[model samples]
Target: MSIEIFDGIFRYGAMTLLLLICVFLLRSHRSIWPGRLGASAALCTAAYLGCTVAEQDWVILLLLPACIANSVFVWMFGLSLLKERFRPGWPHWGLMVLILTTGLWRKFFADADQMIPVVLEWAHQFIIMGMALHLLWVAWSGRANDLIEARRRFRLYFIAFTPVTMIAIAVIDLWLTPDVAPYFLMALQSFSIWVFAMVILLQAVQLVPEVLFFPAVVLEKNLPNVVSAVDQIAARDLATLNAWIEARDGFFETGLTIRNLGDTIGIPEHRLRRLINSEIGFRNFNDFLNHHRIEEAQKRLLDPTLARLPILTIAMDLGYGSIGPFNRAFLERAGQTPSRFRLQMPPGSS
Candidate 1:
């Protein structure tokens, strides 16, 4: 049996599977933040695998963008999975450097045994593993804050699936040699991607978007319109929560946890979480708090009387531990930075 034929079968078969999954992800209105990233990742992964199996130089060159960007798309998709908005930081810049160096190494220093090639290969694996760990961290850290029942349950699986799968793939690529069957290696990588697409497929079901998305946060005024299945028990709980939180100033206290909020508000912590999610339309408790906080932040940013106060002071005053969360929340709500919002909008501008 020819190795070429073996590679041809598995590689082409995997590409077809990836393309089909890609089409499924993009069909209808499913192509949104995380799903869109997922589809792109699938396409990129297929392209990367295709280029690897291609014997021709032109094929490699033509598919190089998707090939190289596979990691980037996967990283971004992982960030989006938990439904919390992602803030780009040093890792993003580091990824760019890795991509640049990897491309340069492949183009100029084709020698496999060279110091630079070895270092580059190891660095690439490190980033892949690091990104997986990051995803694990995001899922674990955000689990308590997540509200959607499906998301809460999925956290455990995600924590296990993301890191192990990613690290395993990295290790397979890093440690395996040409002595091992190349088609087997390629088929294994392709299968890993297949599992990833299937996971995303599970999330993107139109009938149950809750599995994939952040709960829709709504203003108090719009709550009645947004809530669909409020029962008598939920209604009473909602009323109690509404009356209590408005009268209490402790909500403005920094580092307020949900347990503390529940205690002060005189509702069971679990019940409070449910009410906040089902009636008020928030998945994460912090997002609910930030909704109110950012509303006040918007007012403060536009308030001429408070103009003398600094943004940090305003943020700190609103119970944010620091400026970072404050800025992120402000941007999420106002669609711009506080400084920019203040600079651009007149005090009276709506």
Candidate 2:
């Protein structure tokens, strides 16, 4: 009959279900740490839920365990994603402003007589939503170059969980009024249970990433290798390397690309991308391809052997659909205009 009794039952049931599922997963899978982390986070959720049902005198004690769990969840989920993408800075600070302001408005003005507890509820929702939103943004920025699968998974979590958690918080906040039997809180709690269930199911179904189990590697600032890693992702392949070289040779072929070449070699696009980055060290995929195209163009221009050929003919031959991009690429690699370079070369010179 009492709210304390009701909340306690709800929290215990939720925690029990999550723990059982975690135990099942750990048993089914050989991997240990991810399961442990998931269990830890679930336990934290249980503790926080228990806090909701605790007497005012016992609230702080019950909440402490959950707080530790929440912090751990943030770190563990975000550890692999902590490059420039998720590092706390302008975007996070800006999002924090939204959360704090919402708390201030809900606590200070929404229901003044019920301010303290309402504010607490709002603050709880604020923190969860803020984290969810931040992680979503991180996933988005991470996906800018290509749709990496891990990023898609993180984005799904942010989108699916954050709103459910926010709704639950709001329900508990509104339940402060005596006329309400706190159906909102109950509904919200149910949704929270559902969200966790989905997360458990998803983890069970999805392929675990290598990074998820690997010992963490800390990257240092000012390491040249950092930039090199990025470049290798962009450039480092011989076929990719040769593609650029052949393009510069002024071989005119429409729709030439890594994909076409990859198909020819029976390699996938991702593998080709890796080859370009690791084997050749190019920061730009298209640029790497174009550089070789331009070089070939330049040679033909400078070569007395091919000096008599028209620039348009050469441009088309080299994969340039137009003279403009070809000339620009030529100047970038050769440090001068193609015509200028051609004219400067002696009659018998290469």
Candidate 3:
């Protein structure tokens, strides 16, 4: 029933400060859009903290204003990250305004004696859960950007702490009498401080230092970008051998050596070797050979016309030495056993 004697001002203030710093770091990448969302998140955090520290009735009025601004800003920031082509219009603004208005009403003037801030609490929960869900979707759907990656990493670091705090809150609310000091709340606050410290420590290793860490940073920043750069090299005019094309296109039956491929493509053997090893992101020639060959094997296995053929025949057709490695490669690429895939093929299919 009574506020704890310990001031929570420092905790909330520290969180607000850290979030604003993140927002500043994030704003450097505007086209990413999620960066702006992250900045808005920082603003909301600061607003929440400001509300927590307010002392007067006049100061308390600022809480609702802060909540309303944060709700609209956080929601718009979330929508911006969904990759839709069309910009949100008036209806979006109306819905956000409506949500913010209801939140403000609930927080500031719902009933005499401030009956309960139910709408405000629920709206805040909705925002937190919605943001978490969005990050989960981006992680699984392969649309994860750097901002999403940062959020995901932070979520992973802190998820284990949530249930302990929630259970503490619930137990206090239910079984414990109000007169009992909220000791568990203090414990939860301490626990969060530790979690925040751990998160910063872990994240520091991944951050790119502008001058010293550029090479490793570039690789870590985005795998797709590295893949794209290699693809560009492949597209350019290298004196590629006709044999290399044949090897890539499934022409070589046996004795498909790197030297032979280089001879056929007119590129020097060492150059061809380095291109595959360094640029193409594969370690060695055999692994490179298997990748393309397995790609062809996958197509054959999926083809209704080819499905009924003996698995061994498919293996031999793709230049594999035997059915065992062929099936392994197929399963690795397609995520299922070749036999299972064959059985699932439609009636009258290969």
Pick the TM-score winner.
1
The sequence of per-residue lDDT tens digits that candidate 2 reaches over residues 94-170 is 54455445544553456667656566665656566556556556545544232234544555565566544644454
Model 1: ten consecutive residues of lowest lDDT: 221-230
Off by over 4 Å in 2: 1-13, 20-39, 54-60, 63-127, 145-154, 163-171, 174-181, 201-238, 241-350
Writing each residue's lDDT as its tens digit, candidate 3 over 122-147 gives 55455545544554454344222122
Error in Å for residue 165 of model 2: 2.9
lDDT against true structure, model 1: 0.74
Q: Which candidate is the best by lDDT?
A: 1
User: TM-scores for all candidates?
Assistant: 0.81, 0.43, 0.41
lDDT score of residue 183 within candidate 2 = 57
Q: What is the number of backbone collisions in each predicted candidate, taken in the order shown?
A: 0, 26, 9
Candidate 1: the clashing residue pairs are none
**Model 3 superposed RMSD (Cα):** 13.5
Candidate 3: list runs displaced more than 4 Å.
1-16, 19-23, 30-32, 68-95, 113-131, 134-350
Let me know the TM-score candidate 1 reaches against the reference structure. Answer: 0.81
Would you list the C-alpha lDDT of every candidate in the order shown? 0.74, 0.53, 0.49
Q: Residue 255's C-alpha lDDT in candidate 2?
A: 59
